[model samples]
Target: MFLQRVANRGIGLGTLLERAARRHPANILVFDHDLDAAPQLGRRATVGEAADAVADLASRLWASGIRAGDRVVVYKSDGFDITLLAWSAARIGAVPVLLSPQLDGATVETLMRRTGRPHLVTDGAKLQQELSEEVFDASQSVLLVTGSHPRARTLGSFAGVERVAPLEMPPDHPTLITHTSGTTGVPKLAVHTGRTLQARFRPQAAVTAPLRGRQVVAIHVSFVHSRLVTALAISLLRGYPVVILADGGTAHVADLFAGLKPTVLEAHPNSYLQWEELADDPRRPLSGVRLYSSTFDAIHPRTVQRLLAASERPAPVFGQLYGQSEIGPSVVRSFSRRRRQDADGRCVGVPFPGMTDVRVVSRNGRPPSAENPGYIEVKSDGRIVTYLGEDERYREQVTDGWWRMGDVGYRTKWGCVHLLDREVDLIDGFGSTLAVEDRLFGRVPQLAEVVVVPGADGRAVPVVCTRGDVPLDRAAWEAAVAGLPPMAEPVQWKQADLPQTATTKIKRLELAKLLAVGAGQEA
Candidate 1:
């Protein structure tokens, strides 16, 4: 709450974190996951300890020639250390660009180049491998290795370096840069000023304030994502114990939750889908969960039903936020056990009354109406300043103050938002692909995940993953799809086989390309 108040005063994002550490020094800030060991838990840091770590790391970065206004690109495996480094860069008034480890080497190179040859911070071994693979450019950039290497200075080697004072900047000064999930094409870096980033956290604190210090908040979203940073800030400021999980595998999640029994859980929608079986686990790992939060994409109705049913806590609720990387949470809706069945899979509810404004506009510029679904646009305080190196592209999406969301949806008569599909992914014959997928989910009880993409012939193609290894029942599948546009034979994929963005949304464009190449020939 103090952080929220400070954010309202337009404080810098880096300074706000420092204030949180001072306010709640001894509170447990994070439970980081150990990626090297499958079952072992990673390290934990208190607010004071985390703050000190970040300050020390910031000194080290300064010693390594990073100065105010410089850009430092962080490309490392998931862990709390990445977070510390990012904050450290911000503290020194440098912009930190975080790249997901899930990104391919070529994409990484493209992002690094786009950042104007920013300094690279990554594992030494990984850097070498990338260089050998011809994906890294060492000629124009400086490298700051996180691990041992003869060619680069390691993070540990900079211990006890001289500390530098945080540079004072206006609230609107750029402090962090993160890329879009790039589901459609090359990822564009979304630039966030302290003002924009702080605006995001203020709303979160307001929503969760009542449960402050009473909940053990567990997060399993992408480490490089903006959500992680905001969540960490909220937990530290509110004195809630925080747990961070690096992997979203069902077994890993079960193992982690079995011991923690977190009261609040937040993750990507697909991560929740992967862990849906945990709802029925004998240990009842999710039984203590009081709140479940999902963002970035729409979640399935059946998944929400099962998860809420799994929780034994009285008045348990599932909070869904529909948003994008460029803008923070635009719309939010909550589901309780009583209302779970009433939720439409595509209805993302209404925009936050004062924080966001949403409009559905037709291609020819007609006003939005319930009868006519069109492109969705949003004007929000949390919108990013600009896409790094893509100013013109970013400008193209904005008209007046509203940003084109590239989504096809309409507002309901009740003032709720019903999302149909991404503009690029809309298939003509089947109407809304998401609506059809939701119908299939209701009929096919064993379905785990389903994505409808356009086929080479321009018809809807349903690509799905069934729960566990149980084979699909052909008769049931056929019956479920009876009236839909004639589909390409349903392609069955392992959940992990589907290409995904950092936030766990299937990369529809890439997945469609794989299907075109006959990746799922058996279907």
Candidate 2:
């Protein structure tokens, strides 16, 4: 694997952005909201203008007392302004943490406390409504707003301070931190350095199908973990016109493709699978999309097939990527229809061009056999610098040279890798081991989405959402589920629209809580 044996690069993410700015100063760097929206900031921000703005912001942030190694949380959805802030923070050597704008003040507080940084960068809405007036008293650090929406403080306070310009830093400098949507417990923050990010983007960096200097519409939220850091960055770095839709949800995934005609479409499985509802429409959902890629969790193979079939071209434009916050973006990728046929929907293609190594190992540390599954260990130049607060956990994750990802997978007889599931998501029930996804979707029909979740009582069941309003024939679904091996049938089924993460993954933990509340009410 390309990610395993390679050496680290000395170049950091700050240097990369500077390189891009110099190469294409006049070109359009980022396009926010819609092409026609006037309130949008990046409506006309050229590369030179964006670079200058980032430098200006960086300088102001530093002058306001933001420092290198200090944690700065960015609580906004995907847009030109927020991303540019991220670049600005990196240039100034500040570690900017990406958080969901939807996160409540309590959750935000918890995250802020974890990094021991009281400063935050957020929109005007959150500062007033969610954080309340106390956010200023809650932290000793400064709060900077993204736009003119009246945040905790105005940007004009530091008038004459020199703008912090981009500078070269070591590749191992901690640039970004994101929490993984863990299956079993609270999310863990995965750190990534500039070197790790470069390795992840190298292979697909040159492939600009959907976002090739074309108008790109991103519905994926910035806080949804890996989408923004991985797939979305690939588009932004290419100088594509990025239009981030703030109001859209999974329901609008197909619409973004059809309406925007993006050269490429990057979304999550749940978002793409929902397009099955539009299958009956004579018009194609993703009519003008040149490439469609998905990452985060494994998108079911059936979902991938249906998405391909539903597209304007029945041929596969689907790309499956494997990535993590700790390891930066995608280190592996599998693309095309033929490749889809051979995939189980969980194989995140091969290692990217510069990724050092990726491997599946058993308990003994040797490679696992074809029939055996083990922890996935990868070593790359692009791995994270360190965890935010969990130094011990971070150390345990790093072995001799590889980072032991808690995911369980093994290679095929032909040497292709297949993810069985995350080790954390394994459910021990009826003395049989199972992945929640395998039990739920394998038994359901035409399922737009499903989550195999552990109930309050520790029993695992299915929470499902279908594409249409058609009532499920309970008897048929029950019989079909019953026919599966005993371990596969969900203990109970609760059908409703399943909630999704920003990246379009079913938030099983959220659903489980919902289902638990419903169960309590029934009792």
Candidate 3:
């Protein structure tokens, strides 16, 4: 609705490329394969070449039975292929859905069922294993194979449809239909327009590295999520040679850095935290990276220490800051060493150049003072596009153009803002707002990992782990925890190796699910 009401929005991704082509036709646009690994000029395509490629892909999609507004899903490992397909879908007003390639066959099938996309653009093997013949018959979904898919029909097999005809798309055309992680609940689709994404990126263009030759590593996972969205756009717009990590596991990142030697590393703090465990690893130090950025949460103190120690050169370029799907491709950035490593919290750096307004708000939805942590609400140069089916969620979340990201943090005594926790993560067990496991981990050193959630017995419980030796020092641990406020202590503590997300974060929802399942078994 917000996008529909806006004016002069360009046709999402393709038109942007058309404009880019017009400005710099010969400028190198994208570099796909890793120079060190597969070493191929993945594509030396200029803006003009890119635009032409989109048209070619559009023709290909149309021949394969896709049409305007129809969903075209991409679940592949290659980021360059994803970009080309996404751009092609945009060229024909098709809703491009990008998904993580790591998803198993069943998950991919389920997602396809949910989107009801008539066409799936993936390579051969996935088609044979994941997609059922019945499901294919039901939707008449064409499997367009790019790489070696063992079970795919050739492009010539589907002949009657028009090859590649360019279709006009409105400015508010939806280029991307992305989904949240759905770790806590059902994954909801968020539709983004050309304008929404471009406006978000334009401000960041000035703040981020110039769109030219640079070795950039996309450390984030590709799951039709905002983080991947930013990484892709930054790579394309900045003309950076991207090194896509085949694996995003905590253990794999160090190897990626060592092999690729990227100039810029776009990473989340969870991975950085895991890097802390390798502080003494001989190859821990990051080389070639000029700017090291951490997003999603404040860099943990341990992680900061590791990074500080790992830089090959003196005074490693390190910084941490905030951004969300709703308001920022460029939200708030802190480059200063003092602010970057300030675990106590500070401004998320001054707002990006075009960010209009950002503030700390109370639980009741009113603005809070610099010292009081509250929800982070932002009014940016370009607000979010909108949720697909949940229009009310959008309306309620965005007030006077400021998007209320559910995070709770306060502005520092200075201009910096500090995020405490998210509203959903704070349990109301005994009526006090507390960061459940986050607080406990800080208190208990013996615990290697912990996840606190509402237990089946209608009380808060923390599932914990230790390095080894089941030292049931419960009395000591409880006494130490008792010093914490009532809300901070867990009513029960269960011991186990903590479950982590693919991104290595403790899966709180999965933990809740496990608790519910255990309750069901007991019953």
Candidate 4:
């Protein structure tokens, strides 16, 4: 209703590119890799060509028996096609359930079962490698996005299928379904309707209003994320040339940015952490950036300062938003060049004025404070209606109009929200493991990743990964932890060895369990 009342139309992913083409037919989209679904289209295309590709893909999906109200699960290899396939599926009024390529075969099978045996879109590489034959057992039918399989028909098989007109569904129709990060266990599907998604779009889009003309927007966000829907919508509709990356390796990104010189960029916080090295590159990959937006929560202060410094703009702003898939962008904060390098990373900004609100509820009888952080709860029109197959589970997280963020934090006197730790991740004697890690990040520049979790012996352990896989200097480590709460001698591990969610968020519990078996223990 928010979007309809303002724009007189609802947010429909299926027709997004088509609408964009109407406004700016020649707007360009550049990709770091070829799209698996439309590899023939090459690495770049005009908005009009992209619209035609989506329409053609929609017809093929319709020919494959995917219809309005049907559920189609996309579990293909990692590529931008994952995002475009979502659009094509929605164009035909089929709900797209996107699972990350990082998920193993067992996890994919589990999710497919949860999706009511939906038709699966995947590729040959997955079928031969990560996905076991069990996926076919759980899926209604297998349709390949690229490579072929004896059990699945390839999208190329339906090439000449007549284009189908985009179907118009009600504003409340389920537009997309994306999974939770699954840090704790099996991920749950979060369902989003058009109107709810558009509510998220408004506040985020409003922030970009002051920018004159068009700007090239480069993004390295996960392909399956709900944020991509709104992000692509905002950029494309505004006639901005776009750059999308499938890989987040620093070398690849450095080359791309150096050559293309995008003005606006958005990426996951961890990706931003990785990109900090690009600041010192001779090519000045990040110099042209005017706005740095981290579409994830609680980025380290050091990473923020490093990236802002890389931008040669007179006044660059780093935008950080705190939220999860269940509730879209609950709160936002921005950092300018004038801010201190050691700004408090825990103080994740305030809620959106009218579109979002937050209240900290005490777990104990005492008032919520830094020492006794309370449960972070939020109210947003953008909150999902339900978990795909777990309505009761979704209901349990909501009280009145507020949804629990499952994080413990307190609001400052100035109304700044200070995130302390995940409620489930809290340690018995530790004040805030996250805060300690934040401090270590700022003090020791060598740390690429630092996670403080409970060791098997019940002592707080700091697991660290250094940039370039170099060993951390012993003296610097000691000096950094001098004033902090006591922790075990640091355990060094390769960043790849640490368990991570699809979004690159470290799985603290999984790492602790693995540590119980001497996994990733470096002397």
Best by TM-score, which number?
A: 4
Residue-level lDDT of model 2, residues 8-54, one tens digit each, is 46435444445556665555533426321113344556656655666
Best by lDDT: 4
Q: For every model shown, what is its TM-score relative to the native structure?
A: 0.93, 0.80, 0.74, 0.98
Give a tens-digit lDDT track for model 1, residues 294-317.
877778887888899999898888
Which consecutive 10 residues in model 3 have the weakest lDDT in total?
Answer: 32-41
Superposed by TM-score, candidate 3 places the C-alpha of residue 396 at a distance from the truth, in angstroms, of 3.3
Tens digit per residue, CA lDDT, model 4, 140-248: 7899876787888889999999889999888888989999999999999999999889888887887777778669999899999999988899999999999999999
lDDT score, candidate 1, position 467: 80
> Each model's C-alpha lDDT?
0.78, 0.58, 0.57, 0.89
Question: What lDDT score is found at residue 141 in candidate 2?
Answer: 59
C-alpha RMSD by candidate, in order:
3.3, 4.7, 6.0, 1.7
Say which prediction, candidate 2 or candidate 4, comes out ahead on TM-score: 4
Per-residue error (Å), model 2, residue 512: 4.1
Candidate 3 local distance difference test against the native: 0.57
| Prediction 3 TM-score vs. true | 0.74
Q: After superposition, how far is residue 318 of candidate 2 from its true place, in Å?
A: 1.5
List the pairs of residues colliding in candidate 4.
none
